[model samples]
Target: MSVRKILVPLAGRAEDVEVLTTALSVSRAFEAQLVVLFTRPDPTEALPYLGDGVSGQVIEDLMQAAREGADQASGRVKSALTKIAGDAGVPLAEKGGEVKLPSVRFLDVTGRRDEVVAAHSRLSDLIVFGEGTTGVAGGTALEAAMMSAGRPVLIAPQKSWNPVGGSVCIGWDDSAEAAHAVTAAIPFLEEAKKVTILCVGGKELDPGPGSTLADYLELHGVVADVHLVDAAGRAAGEVLLEQAEAAKTDLLVMGGYSHSRLREFIIGGVTQHIRSHATIPVLMAH
Candidate 1:
């Protein structure tokens, strides 16, 4: 399937530019429309938390402040969007309009941020997320998108980049999640100049070998090289990232949250490690 529309959620954080740049690169590659969404937390959410001693005026003032903060952030996000899209030569347009060029649109909404992001993601072909500020909000949005959207999510790198999807790497483990990821990444795989399937640790190949995946990709007219890596007591995620870097991969495709999120958080799994520390773009599916 082709990526026709890309959704990028911006929180007016420091990483907004990096995220927008990454999304625009992919949009250019696929000639897709980019939807830059700005979701603001509902100011009334703080009302229930006000203590008994809090006066009505104080509560009203707090809500006003929250609203002002959200408005300021929205302005900053829109300014950045205008500058980036112009620099990339992508025109801005409205939703449901006929267009002949690679275009972008801005969507501003107020609600629970994660819920709003998840709802919008359901209508898009792909979702792009930045490594947001360290906290629960970013992780919540990611989980919501993966679980609720049923769409591929592309995690932008730590830095801005162009010409993504040129060289690709797939992290295979023979699990259903990994297989789903491979299917979701068909658009990128079919277009990449180089594709590598890296199976880290012999254990993951027992159920379905890397060759099997290679053969599957061949059916889609994608020629891939399979490499079996020996983890040798090192973290599998570390090994996978190192190999991908060595291969000069621009995009890495893999399953996310293959195990339960709780288990991964407690014991540390490949998905967690990569999510926490990848230098390149990652395309993931659940």
Candidate 2:
């Protein structure tokens, strides 16, 4: 199960270059089409603040500035993505296959990030976005797409990254959401040479579930290792992260269990923690 199309939401911020690079790499590996989308605030929505008394000159000037800023950001994002694709030796269609780059397309959209990402996700096989700090709104687009588009999301950190290598660590909880996430992530796990089913808490809570998942993966020709962590004093998210780091896993696949409205995520402490501070990219489904 390889991805055939990927939607990457770019903010044109410097921090997003790594995400763009990661997306391109994945696109090349899977021979998928890459769609880079830049989102801008809708100007019409701001018109309510400009009263009828406002001078035409002022309005024109503001609009021009907005347009210029949007153009500049869009250009930067395009250039960065193009360069990454070129370095990877993937062919760019517009270049007539002379320049190696992925089949890339750029879309500049105005309005809300969530809406734009959700629309693209509906047309794509996967959504990729950058992960930021805890309080800050990092990976908001990815989260929104997951909830609204009913697709899987890949959240990459803001540093240099490599396509997932080695083993994939799966956080197993035996819930319906977890099952869905596992199924959605089968593409990645099948590609990975190794996989681990990690369970937190005691057998009294749930014991054999993780083993069953591991066995299922083994049947698919994926080498799987199952382990249980006590998660006593430490947070579940922290424990998971620590285990992943120790195992040197390249990717973490987990279910996103949420209790609150889609507007904001009200998730378990572990989920929130991993969403806020995981070093490696996370592939999540709800």
The per-candidate count of clashes, in order, stands at 0, 3
The positional error of residue 57 in candidate 1, measured at the CA in angstroms, is 1.4
Question: Could you give me the TM-score of model 1 versus the true structure?
Answer: 0.95
Model 1, clash count? 0
| Residue 64's lDDT in candidate 1 | 91
Task: Give TM-scores for every candidate, taking all chains together and pairing residue i with residue i.
Answer: 0.95, 0.89
Task: Compose the digit string of candidate 1's lDDT tens values, residues 1-286.
Answer: 8888899999888789988998998998899989999998887877788878999899889889998999999998899999999987889986577784588999999998889989999988889988877632247788788877777788886888787879999999888888888998999999999999998885444535789999999999999998888888899989999999999899999998888999988999898888888898888899
Angstrom error of the Cα, residue 68, model 2: value is: 1.1
Instruction: Residues 1-286, candidate 2: write the lDDT tens digits.
Output: 6678889888677877888887777777677878888998776677789999988898888888887888888888888877887777665565334433347877888888788888888878888878644443245676678877888888777566667644799988887767777887777787887788889774354668988898888787777888888888667778888988788888888877444444335445656677777788777788
Misplaced by over 4 Å in model 1 are 135-137, 203-208
